[model samples]
Target: MDLPIETTRLRLTELTLTDLADYENLIMIPEISVGAGFNLVSNPKMLGAVARRQVTAPNSFGIRVKGRLVGAILLHEQVGFDYQPDHANLELSYFLHPDWWHQGIMSEALIKLIEELTASKTIKTLNAEVFSSNQASKGVLKKAGFQKKTTLIDPLVSKEKVIYQRALR
Candidate 1:
């Protein structure tokens, strides 16, 4: 996949350390943090450490609008899922600032990302697990062609989650 994939209203770029402050502000929002299963971190150092890991992760992109970071999208190896790590399977996760919600920003970003990854021909399936209550996220996934694969209680979070998957191959 390429860096800085752009859509009409947004830019998907490699997330960098420079985006730390904006990232912090984004995750500090209760709806975002709690919905994404992130514990609110009051310690700056801890937050920085977490941010560092996210920014450096492969396939992580900062969702920017007018040059301001407002959210992030990331694809990584499936962890607790049954899928094998064959490089063709990945888990998708993302969060957007509440202020940007309901405006189709996340759906646009996700659709573009799906197109790019599918064109790359290196990914076969993209999986996303959202808390059952996150209707907005489910809507975004559905808009991007993901279908609900299953519903189960996530052991890590102890919450009912809906698993969505998009096949590229």
Candidate 2:
């Protein structure tokens, strides 16, 4: 619960309840939500609920730029995922505000996170399932040393999700 990963231009820390408004504003952008999954929140009440859920999620982190929450990154243990037999799996996912896209903020944050998490010895393999249409996410992952393993159709999202993985140990 005390995870905090930092880079030159961004900080990844636990999402707090106080970040609801900023988180909502970032996530409600339709373009941002599409690649990250889900639709924009339609009302303030729904936004509040969504924010609460994120804040309470076990390993979710808010990405800060100049002291403001502009995005999020999460690493979650996969329970029933069809993982490789030799390693436990952790799924990595991230999204940045459209305004910050193309600036390499996410790439920096994620590269640093992988270093920190790998050094901690708490993760065996870091995996990602990105929407096939999301070339930016794919590029970020590949740049951070993840290798494409397969492509599977995700029934929940009704799209092809490309599976990528990197060994931590």
Candidate 3:
């Protein structure tokens, strides 16, 4: 998918190994991916392999700000937390460099992603699970139109993750 989606302040596109340097910081940070239930750091080559696989997954996108890669926003079709699918539903996941925080870059990227996904008929619901303590993530998701669905401690992800959901239709 040649996304190339753009907003006034953000962009969403497919990522390649060339982007390793672009996303190295956020993807490697334990803090960022810790709450999201997936960590990509430990090995650069492994992350590259994952990105390579994702390029064909049809479910994830690289988040860019002003043409520079800053983070990743993905709409996963399946997750262990819940074997749930609303036919066109997706789960929200993202991680960004601390440098991009507070600039509303994520907010913009998310809005554009939702609009694009909806336009493409890719999804109608977007669910997310944020660590209860991760207020920053909660705020970003809230800005993206996701409302609190539930706050149960995720058994699979441990007690830190809290579930949230958004319906696009």
Winning model by lDDT: 1
Task: Let me know the TM-score candidate 2 reaches against the reference structure.
Answer: 0.85
Give lDDT tens digits, candidate 2, residues 1-169.
2367777788889887787778777777888767766464557677678767877787778889999888888777777545543235678878899889989988898888788877878778989988888888899999999999999998876789999999989
Candidate 2: where are CA atoms >4 Å away?
A: 1-3, 40-47, 80-88
- lDDT by residue (1-169, candidate 1, tens digit) is 7778998899999887788778878877888878876665668688778878888888889999999899999888764455455578899999988889999999999999889988999988999999998888899999999999999998877889999999998
Segments in model 3 whose C-alpha atoms lie over 4 Å from true places: 38-48, 79-87
Query: Lowest-lDDT window of 10 residues in candidate 1?
Result: 78-87
lDDT tens per residue, model 3, 81-160:
46654457666778777788888888888888777766766566788888888888899888888888778766775666
Better of 2 and 3 by TM-score: 2
Can you give the lDDT of residue 62 in candidate 1? 96
Full-model lDDT for every candidate: 0.88, 0.81, 0.72
TM-scores, one per candidate = 0.90, 0.85, 0.79
Top-down TM-score ranking: 1, 2, 3
User: Which candidate, 1 or 2, has the higher lDDT?
Assistant: 1
Error of 2 at 48 (Å): 4.0
Candidate 1 wrongly placed segments (more than 4 Å): 40-44, 79-85
